[model samples]
Target chain A: AQRVTQPEKLLSVFKGAPVELKCNYSYSGSPELFWYVQYSRQRLQLLLRHISRESIKGFTADLNKGETSFHLKKPFAQEEDSAMYYCALSMIGDMRFGAGTRLTVKP
Target chain B: DAGVTQSPTHLIKTRGQQVTLRCSPISGHKSVSWYQQVLGQGPQFIFQYYEKEERGRGNFPDRFSARQFPNYSSELNVNALLLGDSALYLCASSSPGTGEKPQYFGPGTRLLVL
Candidate 1:
């Protein structure tokens, strides 16, 4: 079975500090990864996808096939970056999402 | 354009009761998916419908079922509800294509089973 794992349940960092939300997956075939964000009281939205290979909202994720990881990282975190981050894997018909990591960027 | 929309923002029901949740996809979207999200956890896939056909289904029991309409709108029905079924039910829509495309989500319906 395909599975996504987000090791960190909660992360806190000061503003302007670098942050990385680790995500690892277990899949036998080629995997499509994505990052979704849910801000406070807002609907969940797509942040970025590995296939796009484009950074969004100053966040980028690289699909490391060898490591089976697609960790989301940002050089400088902002207060607005505080949200719940979820790593998801696209399957044949269904999609699998990680448990999610909650990041709090303190001012 | 309007995003995915779900009806009945919140619902409360007693055990063994049945409930139905409605969802309308975006204007041009042909695929609609349903998910169940418990507090502090990721959303779990329940069903996916495309062009009014059942494309995918998760490990949910038969009590949980869903169908799509000709217009691509969808409805999720749960029978003999259990306390564990209380959670945020989310609806997502995407273009008729591969799973790589991002699926836009709705605000979700909060369900509580008493």
Candidate 2:
């Protein structure tokens, strides 16, 4: 069974501070990882994917196969960055998402 | 361009009854998938339909059935609804690919089973 785990249910940081949302996965094969964000009153949307190796809105996640982790990080947290962030693993036809971490940035 | 769209943004059903949810994928998207997200939990895959055919199903019971139409729209039917069935049903659309496609999710339909 493939599983994605996001240990933090809530994370709080001050504006301009760095942020890191932890994620771990248990998969036997090579994995595709993604970070999704759901802002207040907005639908879930893709933030970034490991395959693209691109950063969206200062958010970047690197797939660490040796440690089985894909942690999302940002250099500076903004007030607008407060939202629900989910880490997901892409399998055959199924994508397993973590429990999600809600970030609150205080201005 | 419209992104994936779902109908009846909200619904309320009672136990022992059935409910049908509808979703229309974005134009040119060949694959549609369904997921259920209980409060405080991550979304769980329910079904995947591609090219008007059922390609994959999750651990849901047989009471949960879904089908795709020739136009690429899809419907999810749940029978004998239970309080546990109360959740947000999200519809996502994507193109066929091993690693080339990223799913686009709709706003989701909130279902409440009493």
Candidate 3:
């Protein structure tokens, strides 16, 4: 069984400040990690996947197999980046998601 | 192209009743998955259908069942629904053969058990 854990239920950051949303997963074999975001009144959308390693909207997450972590980070937080973020693990044919972290960027 | 679409955007049922939720996957998508999301929590995997076959199932009980159609549409049927079953049912679609294709989620069908 694979499980994703997001320690922070809510993360508040100042605009233009660095932000990090922590995520950890437990899995035996190699896993595909992803970060999904949901803005207010919008459906959840994929922020980025580890396989692609592409930066979207200034957000990037590097998968660390040793630490079993895939933390989402942004150098300069923007108000528009404030939304609910979920970490997910894809293994075999199943996918698991974390509890989600609500990010708020204060002005 | 239209994204994943789920029918009966909102539904209400009582304990011991049965309900069926429908979903239409995006064009060219060959896989459909179902998930249950309670308020204030992450979505839980329920079932995954690829090419109209049951590819995977989560920890849900037998009372929860689903199937995919030839056209890649899917349905989630819950029998003997409990109050705990009241949650947002999300249908996600992806191109399985594409290898690691991201799943696109629907707005979700909100089920209220009173």
Candidate 4:
């Protein structure tokens, strides 16, 4: 069975402070990893994918195979960055999403 | 260049009722996937369709069924809905031939069951 775990349900940080959202997964084989974001009153959207290794909106996530983790990180938290962040993994169409982390960036 | 779109932004149903939700994938996209998102929880995969065929299905029960048309548009049907069925149903489109990553999601359909 495939599973995704996001340890934090809510995280608060002051503006300009760095933040990290932790994620772990258990899967048999290589799985595609991704970070999805949902803003207030907006639809869910893809933030970034591990395969591309690209940073979006200053957020970056690196897939660490040895630790089975893909943690999302940002150098500086912005007020606009407050939203729901989800860590997801997919293999052969079976997508598993971690319980999202609701990030609040206080100014 | 329109993104994936789902019909009936909101719906209300009573227990034992049946509902059909529609989704239109982005133009030229051949793969459609469905997910259910309950309050305070992450979205759960329900089904995936490609080339008008069922490619994958999740742990959902048989009450849930979906079909993809030739144009790649899809419909998700739920039978004998339960109160637990209340959720936001999301539809995503991807081009597997090109790449399946970064599936484009729709606004989602909010279904409230009583």
Task: Identify the leading candidate in terms of DockQ.
Answer: 1
Residue pairs with backbone atoms closer than 3 Å in model 2 (clashes): none
- Between 1 and 4, whose DockQ is larger? 1
Lowest summed lDDT across 10 adjacent residues in model 4 chain B is found at B95-104
TM-score of each: 0.98, 0.97, 0.98, 0.97
lDDT of 2 by residue, A51-92 (tens): 999989998888999999999999999999999999988877
Superposed by TM-score, candidate 4 places the C-alpha of residue A55 at a distance from the truth, in angstroms, of 1.4
What does the interface RMSD come to for each candidate?
A: 1.1, 1.9, 1.7, 1.8
lDDT score for candidate 2 against the true structure: 0.91
lDDT of 3 by residue, A1-107 (tens): 57999999999999999999999999998889999999998887889999999999989999999999999999999999889999988865688999999999999
RMSD of each: 0.8, 1.2, 1.0, 1.1
Collision pairs in model 1? none
Q: What is the docking quality class of candidate 4? A: medium
Top-lDDT candidate index: 1
TM-score of 3: 0.98
lDDT score of residue B46 within candidate 1: 96
Each candidate's fnat, listed in order, reads: 0.74, 0.53, 0.51, 0.70
lDDT of 2 by residue, B1-114 (tens): 889999889999999899999999889888899999999998898998888877778899998999999999999999999999999999999875432268899989999998
Worst 10 residues of 3 chain B by lDDT: B94-103
Ranking by TM-score: 1, 3, 4, 2
Q: How is the predicted docking of candidate 1 categorized under the CAPRI scheme?
A: medium
Write the residue-wise lDDT of candidate 1 on B1-114 in tens digits: 779999999999999999999999999899899999999899999998888888889989999999999998999999999999999999999976754479999999999999
